[model samples]
Target: MKFLLTSGGVTNPSIRSALDGLLDKPVDQCTALCIPTGMYGHPWVGPGVKAWEFVAGKEEGNPMVGLGWRSMGLLELTALPSLPAEGWQPAVRDADVLLFSGGDAVYLSHWVRESGFADLLPELTDTVWLGMSAGSMVTTPRIGQEFVGWQPPGGGDDSTLGLVDFSIFPHLDHPALPTNTLAAAETWATGLGGPAYAIDDDTAIVVTDGGVEVVSEGTWKALAM
Candidate 1:
């Protein structure tokens, strides 16, 4: 699967172009599935208005689901375990992209595995996994202790899906999030003990065929693992 991981959603032209490249066609011609399961696990953004805004394309700073597509639908991971694969797997296979909302990466990772979505990763060879904030973080090897929230049921470590080799620090140097500064990201990287990227709202990391590319219109820094 291809990845268009962003600190924020496609908030700029450059990142939008990168997404278009991943799609290999117009955004209007593609189908998308907005996964808001991650939102419920976050303390700051739990299941309610936030989740509704994301699916309804009302998220203030994050511009994901609002993007006009041929069709858009929801794939709540928490509910997947109760249903049969034949009931939903076909929709996943047919979709052109999966839009993951920002929230708790650890929580999202847990449900991804629990709902059997982890097993479907290999089959989504042509699908794009577009992520924002925690959505993007969940794809990495670990999110570090700094971003840990909504811990797993068995009390696991900060480790995530590890779909990507590096970790991510989202919302770097934002006005409201003082702790998300470059200095903080550096400290977080030190604790991670691995390669990582600290990206601002305008930046995104595109991964395809094992190649890593940064698409940015703002600021970012790469910390050595």
Candidate 2:
């Protein structure tokens, strides 16, 4: 799948051009899924956003991680798209393209697995998968370890969606947000012996059948397996 694994939003012109270039489709038909960065702040973990919210609220961020294609779809004003209680058996089954927004890595991962989207991902080979922050983390083998600071419960499981073999370390050594924490996630990745992709807030990791290419306004380092 093609990916625009951005650190955050593509606010830069050069970045936008680069993003546009990533698409195999024309710009007008380019659709995406937004996952909200705000969902991380919720008290409970995965059952996901309240269904009423989708009908009554408006999330102001990315798509893949937030809702499915509904944002770029028919919905006018909507809330964060949680896993369909009825099941993602149909919707996620045929997504053409997905865009995950920045948010809590743990929450997104939990929802993906709980919602059963993770299992169906392999079916959507025709779809392009793009993730922002937390969205990006979940694409990797294990997001809870490298992105989320909290550990697995005493006996409960914390398995990931396992898209990529690498782990992502976000908001580290960046100049933007002062509230983000690096130590917890950083220390975790260091011990895993897995490759870590360290990205500043301005950078991005572009993936294709060719390879995972680092592209952005600054520097990016990849710790390989």
Q: List the RMSD of every prediction in angstroms.
A: 0.9, 5.8
Task: Report the CA-based lDDT of candidate 2 relative to the real structure.
Answer: 0.55
Best by lDDT: 1
RMSD, candidate 2, Å: 5.8
What C-alpha lDDT values do all the predictions have? 0.93, 0.55
TM-score of each: 0.98, 0.68
Indicate the TM-score of model 1. 0.98
Instruction: Using TM-score, give the best candidate's number.
Output: 1
Model 1 worst lDDT window (10 residues): 145-154
Query: What tens-digit string does per-residue lDDT give for candidate 2 at 1-225?
Result: 666676654535555666667666554555544344324433432226632232222433322323323335321111324535344345444445665655556556666655445666666766676666666776776654334543334533334556776777666566555534455555666665677776765677777767777776755566444
Mark the regions of model 1 whose C-alpha exceeds 4 Å error after superposition.
Answer: none
